[model samples]
Target: MISVAAIDARIWQAIVAGAFVAIGWIVNGWQNRRVAAALRAERTRDVHRALYAEIASCLANLDSPEALAAYRDAMAARMRDDPGFVPLIPRERNDTVFRALVAEIHILPRVTIDPVVSYYSQLFAIEAMIADMRGERFRALEPERRIAMYEDYIALKVQAFHDGHFALRMIDAYATDGRNGAMEEEARITREISAGFDTAGAAARAASRISSPGAVRSGRSPE
Candidate 1:
């Protein structure tokens, strides 16, 4: 013969306890989600920072006046010396950061990912061409063909330089949180520089020179 009022009080107590448990669970879940989001944002920023440094270094090496002059001299030497002479093409062998974080690159902004990937892909292409130039088939090619191949390699490097610029622009935009005019000036400068570099015309000139009556003859095949 328990009183009804006592039973009702117990029921209210249980309800209150259940309500508190639900609120605690909700708060804990919300906290965890907030922390995860923050971590993701931080990781994205870290990727951007590392990639920016690497790309900037590459741009510095490739787009510098000294580098351009060195490349021009090398090509001229190759054209003047034995046609079989392989010009030393400067390229980066270090891609550790990109290789390590490529899988997680998807975590970056959608717009940034493509340009970044494109830049690296161009680098890969350059590497492949370098490898081919060192192979036996390249040595077997005619003098004009060899010049054309070398010209193509230069064109690839130039393309990679442009692609690197695009990647940096995208990264800058993301790092600035999509701020208006964040990379506008840089983009305009890039466009102007790109306009000045005519890869196709240069390649055409090289090919035309080698095709003329008097061209450097191929030397002994590389050992």
Candidate 2:
């Protein structure tokens, strides 16, 4: 039979060993979590960087009407090849940046104008139309068929624009009849539309320049 002292010593030794194991496990787990978090952060940063690069490319290439036309054609072709490539909308770099800006703006207790929402909504609709045109279903059609569809699409766009204009006018009339708040809202939306147009024009000019042969050559040079 073991002595009481020996038994107690053995029990203590086992407890010590178990404690070491637990501590090691905890350290390893913490290290793993840190590593995983760092990796996730790195991935997010990389994605944002890539989006920025693409946006810059779009802006640079906007100058060349021929290039822009070619880009549209290529995009259409891509859509024909892969239907799943279609995004719900075309997202501009400024759009994402502006959203972040608008979020910050909204933190103010009182924003007299709600430009952000109206601008983003209109931008989203335009993007959606572009995405739809680039889809495989549209691209797969014959040239004649595609042209026909495009006409219809343009017509629908025109109709929608008219409807939106009418709605705004009606709202303005109602506002004039009663509350000043409605007029304020209309003014905000108008401001957003103007800003969007200006930004788009800038983006288009950048895009055109990027399509130049010299620009293409420079872009291909080793950084």
Candidate 3:
């Protein structure tokens, strides 16, 4: 039979061992969580960085009508290849948020005061019209009506492209006329708007909200 003292000592040893094991498990779990969170943040940051770069490239190419049209076509192709690129899906709240943000930024008079603003405004109007037509309520419309709406959308897109080209030509003319300061001002405003949209904190928050597990089920994410 074991002595009482020995029994008590063994029990204490067991308790201490268990406590250490528990602490180790907790520390391991915490470390794993930290690593996973960091990886997720890195991935999200990369995605948003790519998106901002694409937007900046598009804006820069607006100076060339051919490039603008090419960009638009590339965007349309991407939308076709990746349904996620289309903002029509209700579950894709980020898409809608991005579109709304772009529209709001475009409409701001600070940047829109330039002649190019008219062209962008028209482009945004077409985008809004397309969004409306894709809404759930519009699904019940007759086939013919849907066709007409689509035709109108195409027409608007083409007209906006032409207008954008014309605006680019005007910008070129201004450059030739030595109104370089005005062009510089426009470029500065564009950079400011891009910076505002691409701020790391804001993009991180937006990505976090969109990628949250709860957002997947809700079809919407918190602002």
Measured by TM-score, the strongest candidate is: 1
The positional error of residue 25 in candidate 2, measured at the CA in angstroms, is 0.7
Q: Which residue pairs in candidate 1 collide?
A: none
Give per-model CA RMSD.
14.1, 17.3, 17.7
Tell me the spans in candidate 2 whose CA falls farther than 4 Å from its real position: 61-124, 127-223
Please report, in order, the local distance difference test score of every candidate based on alpha carbons. Answer: 0.65, 0.44, 0.45
- Give the CA lDDT, 0 to 100, for residue 144 in model 1: 69
lDDT string, candidate 3, 19-133, tens digits:
9999999999999987766664443333333333333233343333344456555555655565433334221121332353453333222221245556556657776886786
lDDT of 1 at 94: 42
Q: What lDDT would candidate 1 get against the real structure?
A: 0.65
Question: Per-residue lDDT for 101-163 in model 1, tens only?
Answer: 988887876566777899899988888998888787877877667778787877777777667
TM-scores of all models? 0.73, 0.35, 0.34
How well does model 3 score by local distance difference test?
Answer: 0.45
Best model per lDDT: 1
Question: Which of candidates 1 and 3 reaches a greater lDDT?
Answer: 1
